[model samples]
Target: MNGDWLLRGRDGRLTVYLKSDDAVLCRAELAPGGPWEPFRRIGGDLGLQQGPAAVGQGDDGYAHLVSWRQAGTGESRLVHSTHFRPLLAPLDWSPVGHPNGRGDRTGTPAVAVDDRRRAYVFVRNAGGGVSLLVQKERGGWYPWRDLKGSSIQDQLAAASRESGLVEVYAATPERILHWRQEEPGRTPTRDETADVAARPGTLRALRTSAERTTLFFTDQGGELCAWRPGGKPVPLLQAAGPGPVAAVRCEIDGHDCTVLAQRSASGRVAFAAYPTEQEQAGAWWTESGPPLPPAAEIALAVDAHGTLVAATLDPTDATLRVTRRKAEAGLALEGWREV
Candidate 1:
């Protein structure tokens, strides 16, 4: 599942972007916790490949979206479009030439928009190493640069911290490899000190604080774990399903807390809340709604009112099913509704 399928805008409006057979479609909330607008095609008319898609929103409220279109042989040509401001509408998409030449076979890409409004797109190169393409100051893109990683999984993550520096998290069978800029507007270097192990396709990185990013992943024991750059892996939940977990740090009961939306072992959407980085203090998890199929993923976001919003694309009908936690009602969830 893509991390950005469901995300709230800077103005408190939530937008969901999904990949269909031929194009990418999106729906924007008319207002925060309000009615959603009708789905509109946003990927131009490019022939998109059958793959996962990603979306990154800048501090300016602009969104940078990326998807793959079939290229020569088995490779894919990367195509991108920007939704200027918070409108969540794009006129067309332009081709961002692949790093390994004409889409020479790459993994799923992740996008992170820095404080300067530049978009950093990360992907696994043809040789299983990570490479990234950066958006220049104006509008053009710089050539792809390899980040020196190996055996990296296709499921990876990239996030921008409050300091404006961007950090990328990827997993190999052996350990977790990371790339973080020493400061804003600099090239990210591999930080081998991040010693952690994660199962393939289950690693996620998000900035839960102004200067720190926490990683969520399933360990060899199948338990969900959280880790930071200089800390040990902290077990957070048990029997977590495969794929990435959608998490956000927000307030609950006037306390700073981290909320998690995960697919549980029973194939249901499970949510948990605990004090930020305080696993030893205990956390609570609850499952709700129907047991979803393995292919579907739950998207989580916190609205302007600090309410948690979770949604999943129904694999059967391709419709979006959403639920949100009642404001200040602990972890209580509202009934699921079809959108």
Candidate 2:
């Protein structure tokens, strides 16, 4: 599955990422509700595979991407690249060596920028535990540290609070393992387990408030569930599908709401909105735009005008297809258009 492709910068322009046959491609919107510039290759590496795990910062006007490319020795080398934000050209990628060093087996990588403007990358190691590498604010990396959590699976979710504190989560066989910084600009000491069961590829974490986050995932029964740290797991909707779920916190019709999008079982992109952190309030899914490819991932964000935007790969081609709502049309969407 692809990593995050749609990102919004501090200045409000949208950056989109796509995977080509050999390289990772990116493009940006000319304006909030305008046409996008042509796609360009981010790096010269032909060994790059899959979409990148993308992170955009409002603090710094830059987009950060982490992905793995094959080395001459058949090792999975992890690399990171940054873009000059508000829609500028890409820069040279800085090499972030693999977590395992030898690059044996690494899971999907998760990335987030801390409040101090530093970036952290997390991935599942070969031992079924998590390892991390932290980049300093001015561009230097600390030694790779092994974050112990046995029997961990993929789909590790991570987010940094406004305070510059970071949290990393991994799904184990029977529960969720969480590691968080004790304070801003500090490395997390250890792992704390949350007795929550989530499907392997369906975990997503987004900030519900200034420095707090809520995790969303499907249960074994395929029902939507939400859990905030130090709180009980709240079962949301029944059978919200087992596909990748996209979420963002934004204001809708004068109310601060949390919005979620997922590809329904019938292949259409559908979404629902509810009060942020209030999953018990009940929410309904509304199908929007058109049906996407069965395996396509939806990228959702709020634009500069507070307008909600959703993007996905075209059902038949390499182009990006995007859909947004009308001026005052709630979730009712305008038609799908290409980048």
Candidate 3:
């Protein structure tokens, strides 16, 4: 499971969408930090192979999700749904719709919402090129528009800002490709980032501020790496483990920080913090704390009050566990509590 499957909604609620036995299950916290509701079957029976990619709090304050479902005939389709009242009882979801047309060989879909509250879904089309579908504020989805780029070698990541710009990134075999659109209904500009061999399906992106964005991925040598828009690729750790990497932009000790978490090669989950202006220095990854139980998947996020929380699925027992670190603790194992 990809840790990016968990998202913090606009209302400050955490919602997770995962795949289990041909079904897509959704579980969300009643509030930010605890007492998660029972898992609910949102979409299923279409052969969901990958977990859903979601974005919360679009213009309508609802969560938008996209996933790729395979049929018995071996045909794949991109499906989408939205939660009407994600934070309240009687939660409702829109009907599942195939946005990429039936029988399209699309990679796992990624979603992001721009400043206008319009939701954009990115996927690799049957031709191996990137394509996008847009959903407007009034609850209508536009037709698929091809972004027209080189063949995508991995899943895509997307980030948006209040200025109505949506940026999408994908890794080719040799380098990462970036596409930027300043507003909805506008053509996007394309560019290439650092020249490094990126592992498939490991690319992730986060918008740290109005003027800064960060990209994280594992390189061909299994080392965790990061790259900014115009900076060179920097290796953060040597030979990190094989799991999804997650990052969140938050405040730590009254300073802006980007917390990165991933499983180490020894099966322990560890995290490090990179303060502002130190991300590209290549020597700033804080000391990793004690290991947790071997995790099949991990998710990381920051609460409304600047608390760092982590959730991991224990591979041994197949149980989900959560831990949190307060700001004053500075990412130490002693400050982490299993909640």
Which runs of model 1 end up more than 4 angstroms from their true locations?
85-88, 193-195
lDDT of 1 by residue, 249-316 (tens): 87778888888888787888888888887878776668888888887877877777767788988644
Model 3 bad stretches (over 4 Å): 1-3, 43-61, 70-72, 84-86, 89-101, 280-295, 314-318, 333-339
Global lDDT of each candidate: 0.80, 0.75, 0.67
Residue-wise C-alpha lDDT for candidate 3, range 1-339, written one tens digit per residue: 332556666677776666564556667788866677877777434445554444434544566666666654756666666665546432333333443466645566778777666778887776777888887668777777888877787488887755667888888898888888855667556865677878887887877767556778889998888777777887877645676687887777777887777777666676777775475554333434456565467777765455777766553444566667743556654344433
Residue 285 error, candidate 2, Å: 0.9
Candidate 1 overall Cα lDDT vs. reference?
Answer: 0.80
Per-residue CA lDDT of candidate 2, range 233-288, in tens? 78888644668688988778778888888988878888898988888788999887
TM-scores, each model vs. reference: 0.94, 0.93, 0.84
lDDT of 1 at 150: 84
- Taking the candidates one at a time, how many backbone clashes does each contain? 0, 1, 0
By summed lDDT, the worst window of 10 consecutive residues in model 3 runs over 88-97
The most accurate candidate by lDDT is 1
Order of quality (lDDT): 1, 2, 3
- Which pairs of residues clash in candidate 3, taking residues 3 or more apart in a chain or in different chains? none
- Evaluated against the true structure, the overall lDDT of model 2 is 0.75
